[model samples]
Target: MPSQDEILAVILGGGRGSRLYPLTKMRSKPAVPMAGKYRLIDIPISNCINSEIFRIAILTQFNSVSLHRHIYRNYHFDNFHTGWVQIWAAEQTMQNADWYQGTADAVRKQLFEIIATRAKYVLILAGDHLYRMDYAAMARFHWEHNADITVAVQPVSKDEAHRFGILKRNPNFQLTEFAEKPHDPHLLEELVSRDDPQKPYLGSMGIYLFRTDVLVDLLNNYPLDDFGSHVIPQAITTHTVYGYDFTGYWEDIGTIRSFYETNLALTRPNPPFDFFDASAPIYGGTRFLPCSTVYDSKMKNVLLAEGCCIDHADIQDSIIGLRSQIASGVKIDKSIIMGADYYARTDQVDIGPIPMGIGQNCQIEGAIIDKNACIGKGVIIRSFPRGTDLDFDNWVVRDGIVVVPKSSILLDGTFIGPGSKD
Candidate 1:
């Protein structure tokens, strides 16, 4: 069996999260604020730390400044600890002048740096996913099976199977074939890897554990752009590939709707993914701020972070992020209020006409109020109808969810969503 030190973790910070735009417009996908306080990148990094696999490298390409800052401030290892986390951004080099084409290409460009780590196995992860797994267990599975590549898979229903890379495995759990988002019913029926009728087909989770030697060989020979689109299918034919079934809560929050729903889901009595685990706690930035203060507010099922002040507001089933300020008579429901990055200096009169937080008597529901947005007095923001996709000067309605972009200014009495006449 291989120890945790023998494996290296490579997290792919996806390229230009177009699906999660406006949020990804300013920061990288992983850097997007998640669950009120933590960034999406924190999930994978925290999992690695909890599993005692800390020699990690994140491959980033687009909009990475904020992502880089978060990593630098949160994940610094001490001198005594042998483990370290580093970022490998796409660059123009003498060998290659293009940006990362896809997942495999990103890793391929950084192959020399990865090879220098000299680890026996490489664990690849996607940064935009929400899940908790003991990767050390996966490593053990790979070692026990003597597998060249092991993909972490989850079962999807027949209807949902077409949206994923379906896998077929033999009785011994070794992968025999692969299908990339096959829509044909006959094809899906043939690819069922499990006995369950509801979710019989095994879908790839975009998580792969590769023998270092085998990964090097494949990348050198395949010259493919994507791992799911090209590499894994080819590896099934030439190398010993296996499937590791993971039966747990996993979500790919790569789009606005998924991200919105996932954030609000945390406000439930029992969230699908637990963050309160003491043994495997999710790590994040240590901002030494004062406790959140509320005054005569009616709140329920809300996840409130530090440095927030809610005054006479009615908030339910929402996530109020750090340094958030909600004035009196404000009502927020099923929304994600990503609070301001910094507090508005009260001492400075030069602060703009509209403050940096939600103003008095504002009504926000089923929306995502991004960081540093100033919602003036009596502003209204709500979810639009299904298939509602429109872009305004300061906000965007995507997938029926109204999103106020970062550092936007919604003037007093501004109307958005349903009843608004823009």
Candidate 2:
């Protein structure tokens, strides 16, 4: 059996996340804010910790400043512990002078450093997913089946099958065939793993477990660029690959629409993915900030983070992030307010006339206000119909949701969305 210590997790920090645009404008997709306080990268790292897999490496190529900073502050194994978290950014080395071509190439470039860990297995994970998984259990299954590679798969419906790499498996859970985003009706039917009508095909969750030696060999010999497009298909033909069924609430936060829906889903009364699990708790940076203080706020099903001051606000089905300041008469519904990085002090000079956070009497609906956004008083921001995409100086609409990027400033009485002037 594979012990927890013998497993090294290598989380892919993803490419230039063009699908998740303005959110990825300043930071990488993995570093994007999630739920209220945690980041997308935090999910995988926290799961590794909970699974007792301590040796981890994060492969970052795109904007990774925030991701690196978060890891430095949040994850620190003490001197007594042998565990360590490494950030392997893309570098132009003597051998390779190019950036990470894809997921496989990213690991191929770092194979030298990864081989030095002397671990028995390597767990490949995606950074921009929302789920809680016990990787140790998957490791045990990998050992029991004596498989060279194990891919984590979840049952996805035909409607959702077009978005993921679907696979067909045998009764013993061995993956027989794999197809990347098969849209044809005949091929989709052939890929069905179960007899269920709703969810028939098994979609790859972009998670793979491999024997360390086998992984090193495949990357060295194949010269492939991607796992989904190239590597996995070849591996299935050559290696003893198996599928581990995962029936959890797994979501890929790859697009603007998915990101928006996933964030708002957390505001539900009983969310599919809850962060309050004490046994397998999600970990993040420690700010040591005071508890949020809400005075005369009519909030329902809102996940408010720490260091926030909400006074006389009517917020419903939303997520207010850390250090968020919501003034009186603010109305926010079905939105995600990623709070400021720092609380602006009254004594601080050079700060603009409009204060940080939402000003008084602002009406925001179905929008995502990124970090450090300064919305002035009487600012009316709302959503538009699906397929409505427009870009302005301060904000942009992608998939009908208004997105105010980081450090954006909206002037007093600025109107956006439905009836607002561009």
Candidate 3:
């Protein structure tokens, strides 16, 4: 097994997550909050740390202020230990005047620094995925096979193959052909194996392992700007590329619907991705807050974080974030309420008619209330009656769920449902 010191992990923090919409309106995709308490970047960072790979770099470009702050404040290594996590934001220099054109381009821009690390292998990962992986095992697989590039792939359904890069591997797991989002059914069928017709296609997980020399040579020589789209296909013809099959829970939280579903899944009795694992725990910033106080509230299947003050309310299958303030007679179900940044002071005046947090008698269902939002009294956030998408003054109906933007205020008696008019 290769020592952790021989590998350098680089997490690719993606571009403006337009699919996640209003959530990414303020923060980068990787910096987006998840499970109430942790950021999306924390998943990969935590995994790398747990795998004993300490030297890491996060490559970010769009809306990186919050991402930078969270990384700087939380991750620190002692002088005695050489392990450290750092951020490599996009910059314009004489050599490279443009921003990161694509994933491959991002790494090319930072090639100088990457080569400086002097690591034997490079592990590239996506920042917005949710899963627990022991990368050391993948590294061992790569070494044992003597593969030039090893791509971590998962068996996805045939219907979903169109959304990801599909690959065909031989009996030895050596990648023979690669297709980026194939539209033709004939080509898709060719990618699948003859043995298992059910899971015919192997979708690339955007996780890659490469020998240091191979990675440097490919980036320096190829004009390709994307791995799945360009580099991987070309490499299959010349270099030895292998696919490592990963059978585990992995979800790319790229779209709003996926993000919403993933969060709600945490309320399940036994979620596929468990955060309660003692051996491989997720790490985040430690916020010193008082214990949550629930007064006369009827709650079930809720993951309430620290510093929450819940009054007489009914909550079920929800994830309440830190310092969430739930008032009396509020009924919440199948919702994710990201709590306020700080407590609303008694003397602090409201910026609008509604104060911060969910107001009294508000009935919210299948909704995602962003951080620091103010829901006024008697507000009803539910699906539209007419099943039509509506973007109101305070919220928007996305994937049939009410999404209240960060710091938005819904005025008193605001009723948003199907067929809401302007």
Off by over 4 Å in 1: none
Ranked by TM-score, the better of candidates 2 and 3 is 2
Model 1: per-residue lDDT, tens digit, 166-235? 9998889999899999998888778978999888889999999999999999999887889998999999
Ranking by TM-score: 1, 2, 3
Q: Write candidate 2's Cα lDDT for 274-320 as tens digits.
A: 88899999998789999999998899999999999999999999999
Q: For each candidate in the order shown, give its overall lDDT on alpha carbons.
A: 0.93, 0.93, 0.90
How does model 2 score by TM-score?
0.98
Per-residue CA lDDT of candidate 3, range 1-422, in tens?
A: 66778999999999999888788988999988899899999999999999999999999999999999999999999899999999999999999999999999999999999989999899999999999999988988899899999999999787788899999999998999988888998898789843666777899999999998998888899898988898899899989999998989999999878998899899889987999999999998789899999999999999899999999999999999989999999999989999977887777664566778999999998889999999999998776432445566668877787889999988888877665553
Would you list the clashing residue pairs of candidate 2?
none
What are the candidates' C-alpha RMSDs?
A: 0.9, 1.0, 1.6
Better of 1 and 3 by lDDT: 1
